[model samples]
Target: MRSLKILLLSSAFNGLTQRAWLDLRQAGHDPSVVLFTDEITVCRQVEASGADLVICPFLKDRVPEQLWNHPQRPVVIIHPGIVGDRGASALDWAITRQVNRWGVTALQAVEEMDAGPIWSTCEFYMPADVRKSELYNGPVSDAAIVCIRDVVEKFATGFVPVPLDYTQPGVIGRLQPNMTQADRTFSWFDCAAFIKRSIDAADGQPGVLASLLGGQYYLYDAHLDSRQGTPGETLAVQDDAVLVAAGDHSLWIGSLKRKAQAGQETFKLPARHVLAEQLAGVPVLDSSIAQQRFNALAYQPIRYRETDHVGELTFEFYNGAMSTEQCQRLVAALRWAKARDTQVLLIKGGRGSFSNGVHLNVIQAAKVPGLEAWANIQAIDDVCQELLTARQLVISGLTGSAGAGGVMLALAADIVLAREGIVLNPHYKTMGLYGSEYWTYSLPRAAGSEVAHKLTEECLPISAVQAMEYAMVQDIGPRCPHTFDLWLSQQAQSALTNPQYRDARARKAMLDIQQIERCREHELAQMQLDMVQNRQQFAEKCRNFVFKRKTCQTPQRLIAPWALTYEAGMPESRMLNG
Candidate 1:
């Protein structure tokens, strides 16, 4: 293949976009990104970018007629649907309608949205129990990458795309209307399965709206329960999640966004916290003794299990945001897991995200936002300390994208293995904080001090492969979740007898505690100024993120120059626009 000059124009540099950018670069092609700000600006950027082709991996904004019709270059749109599928809610409809098969299509940009002729299409069996966000980041993203690679190859070969034909076989998809709030509305009287599907379809965005505790709230992070209870009643509360009865069975809800009242900002929080007053008398189920107690809830966000010589610890927080209490609980879990007889400890994250650092929503919702923010960061630091000073060989398995302090927390482990196609944003400059997770010690040790400085200052998102090159990760695992699990197990079991593991464990034991503590102290001092003093407007950033405010203009850092230089090759930050 030739090294084509490609431009990635996206609404935001999200996970899929970052993956596309990395794949293109790894394939020896020059790729740059231009964030979609407005119609005029997008057109201007596209015209100015000297590229042979342009791809919109996750664009929400429509391409302008001028750029789409330009004869000098070709513009392709990566749609999350199969042939003949047209609409913004393609995946949402697939989940809610319980479609068995779904696909991703790469089509030429035209006047009509998602109605262009298809260049390449790839399909997969739709997963039933997965959340909408997980589906997008997983199967949908995998298929889109396939379509994208195919489109790029076909473009290089001067191949023409097939037009949409209703009579053609496998063309089962059709135009789906944009999913509205009404489409996602579910009553407590609805069956558990129906309610779970409704809520799953709308996860990560506008959640399913329902009445709870005599108030209206948007529900998210749904999980089915086996126990039955009276419809519309709160059954129990555990791990900040509330188990409630539905029409047929019961389900667990992890988070809720209360309906905004006059002059109030609506943001998602732990379900129990949202209804703290209303559910004050509700029983809090003890997960440690759930099996012993009849009718006990079995919800566990942080789970630990042993397999032979490996102790696997999985922490799947909602949207990868760890609240203060959650962090404290995880610290205890880590201590317990470290005491196991296993030779290697594997720390795994959720499918949707590994960890995105402190819970901004929880902090913003607190009575004293700054103090809460301080506490949250401090709590997360303890998690890092546990990993850094672990007695056994520790391996951090990143199955999803991570950012900010989350990346630092992963680095605290002896060996970091990331799933292929995952992105890691290892800087905190975008969030306007110096950041602390003992990053000052771990980052420099993993990656050299010079690269660490460059990464922090540049605020660029690196792909898993790039992370490996910078020594941020020891290896890259498979993209598929099941396959990665197998690979993680094999690797963990092999690490017990590997000389590298023994050497790494010895190095960890010999690490100077005094120096690590000093680094944490210095980092926390800077963090205190950033969080407690609010010197860099972290509160404003948090509010903007929680409110989903759109950026009017692309930051100078994200805008690719007309002349691509070697220094400007890295992918831009995706969370900056958040």
Candidate 2:
């Protein structure tokens, strides 16, 4: 197919949009992203892009008439629904109703929203139990890709889209309302399956509203329990999960989204922490005794799975933030896995996060912010050091995004592999942190001195493809995050069995020894000096960022550098966030 000029418009450059943009670019098409910043700016930006087509992967807003009805282009919207499915809550309805089948539709952008002409459609089977976000990001994302490619390929052949007709036969989908709290209201009188369905529908957002112990909280991250108990009664505490009554059955509450009360900021925290006072009187089951009970599906912070002499360790921290406690736990996990008899080990992070460096939220919440920041950095350094010195072949696999120290820590592995479209922010200047994850040793060694300096000073976000070019990563996996795990396993397993890899291990060990001897201790000592002397400023910045809930905006220097003086009124323009 010939290369076409494509314009992508979305509320944010989220996972779906990133994947579609990268895929289209690799297929020899030019694609540019547009954030709905303002009406006038966006209109001027789109017209300047000279786009032959427009694709909205996960856009919530409708396109304007001037651009949607371009005289020389086509506008397409990739809807997360099946053919004839017209609504915003298609996935939510499927989960709550426990539908066995689901799908995605690619439709032309006409005035009447999803009622527009269908370009392509793809369907997939669904399991009986799954979360709303998990189903959307996994199977739903896969189907959307298939439909998008089909539509794009057909359009390249000069094919016009067919209009939607309700009279047509073999249509199963119908319009549905947006899933709201009213749709998810259930009490102890409901059956176990009913409770689970309600929770699934609101698992990712606007969780089911309920009250316990005279306080109202939104419950999320639910796991079904096989044990039965009386309705509305407290059961037991399993790790961070809280077991609560669900009619005759039970379910584990992994986290709670508390409402703002008494002029306090509303935030989500672990169930155990949020309900500490009330749960103190609840029965606490012994580990061995709890083992005898029916299967309990509580949250697993760290999990290890082995296949063909390769062990994969996955650490799914919430929002990719690694608190000081979380860092220490991951260190212990890495040490235990290293002592095992496996020939190769894979460090797999979460779907939405690998590690975004240290947890700013936890740091700001600490009693002494400076002391907590100091301890957190050291804990992560120990984790990186362990992976750097492991005897087995260590592979750091980033299934999600990584930033700051998180990006440097992943470099500890002998081979760093990332899923396609994964964003990496290797700089820490935004948080007023010089950073201390042994970056001084790992970064320059990986990408050379020139690129390392530029990366830190520029504060630019690099894509997976650019990381490969800069020698910062070994390989890039599937464009779709859903297919990354399978592709990574195939590559790593094959790499382990190669005879040449066995001989290369000796060289790797020697280099590791040399790095420790020359750079590790020296860099860490300097970090201590920098952080200790700048304690007050560091503390204030972190507190401001966390309490104010600020996001990292693209640095103006990156777009209009002071080094270059442009003509007046001709400002340098760029994307919303680099």
Candidate 3:
């Protein structure tokens, strides 16, 4: 295919857009991507881009006719559902309905949204009990790639798309209205899975509402609970969560937001922590304090299981943020797992995200943000240190996206395996922190010095397929999690059967130890110095980013620095907006 300039536009720079950008660029297309910042001026910028095709993947708003009907340009919007499924809540509705199959559709941007002529479509079976974000990022992304590549390839050949036909027997989808809180609402009569599906549908934002604790609150981050209790009662309180009763079973809610009154500002917080005042009489059953007493409420954030001599440690944290306490607990778990008789260690991260490094939310909420940030990184360092110096054969199995310090943590393992469609953001400069977790050591070792420099400095997300080349990902597993887990287990069992397994394990462990020894001291020193003597206001930057208060334009380093200049008498810092 001839190289065509493609401008990738989306609602925001999310996991899906990041994945599409990398895939399109790698396919030899000259792709320029931008977020829809709700700016009218951006339309002029789109025209100025001189792109042959404009691809809008997961757009909240319809593409303007001016841009779509350009003389030589083609505008395609990637819809998250089937051909005729027109709405903003495609994935949310699918998860809520528990449909067996879901898909991505690409169509021309016409007057009617999602009623445009169809370009391409790809279907995927919906996974069991997965969150909306996970479904969107994983299966939806992979299918979108197929749908995207097809449209681009056909467009290059001047192939015209077929218009929508309501009478067509093959067309199955119809309009689905935007799912509201009322639509997702359920009572105590509903089973655990039904309630969970509702929560997962609204996982990322605008959680499902339920009247509880003598008031109304929207719930998020729910887990299946085994223990039974009186229907609609708060049975127990665990670390930052509450086990609330359902009809058939119970659910452990990790996070929620109290419905705001007339003028109150509401924020999503850890469930139990926010409701501490309301649950005054309820027993607090944190893992550290009363693990045995509240064994039913005791949720292990990290757990280890062995089968066929393979020790699999699964760490499924919410949004992949590793708080200081979470990291310390994970370290203890890792140490205990390492002593097990298993020959291979498989580190499985979360369903939504593999990891995104230290908990920015926790750090930002601290009394002293800088000191808290320092302590959290140090805590994670212990977890990574165990990975670096481990004697067992370690392989990081990433079923979901990973970023920043998490990327480096994956690299610390002897081998990294990821599902086909996962994305990776492996840079720290975005947060303005000289990151710990032996990144300076792991990154270069995995991708070499030059690629390492470009990756960190560019601060771009890479697709798993592209990541295989640059990030040195050892293997790309099955696209489906069910098949992926089966295949992964088989591989671990196969490794046990290898007569040379002992020799291989020893060889890899020795090499990693030698590499760590060479740079650990120097890297630690630089990180400490950068943190303690933060002349660049690193903590302030982190705080702003966490709070979504970043207002500065793109730094000069990314674009032409000469185009921006300070006023002669004003400060150089005033040069941010030319």
Please, what are the lDDT tens digits per residue for candidate 3 over residues 1-578? 88887777776667877777778778876577655654453465465555678889867776777777776777899999987888989988998888998899999998887888999999988888888877877788889989999999999999888998879987889998988988999996689889988999998877898988887899988888888888789998866778889989999898877798998656666776577688988887645321322132336556666786788888878888888877887887788778878878888875668899988777766677667777888888889999877767888888788898899889888778788878898888767766678887888877889998888888888878877787568678887877887777776666644563444454474565666755666655666665656645677776576656633332323221111221233443333211
CA lDDT of each candidate?
A: 0.85, 0.73, 0.77
- Mark the 10 consecutive residues where model 3 has the least summed lDDT: 558-567
Q: Report the C-alpha lDDT of model 1 over 114-204, residue by residue, as the tens digit.
A: 7777899999999758889999999999999998889889989998777778888878888889999988887778899999999999998
Q: Which rank order by lDDT, best down to worst?
A: 1, 3, 2
Clashing pairs in 3: none
What is the TM-score (0 to 1) of candidate 3? 0.87
Worst 10 residues of 2 by lDDT: 558-567
TM-score of 2: 0.79
The digit string of per-residue lDDT tens for model 2 on 107-216 reads: 88877778778889889888567777667666777777788678779888887888887787857788787877788888965766677777777766667888866788
Can you give the TM-score per candidate against the true fold?
A: 0.93, 0.79, 0.87
Clashes of each: 0, 0, 0
What is the TM-score (0 to 1) of candidate 1? 0.93
Q: Which candidate is the best by lDDT?
A: 1
lDDT of 3 at 567: 22
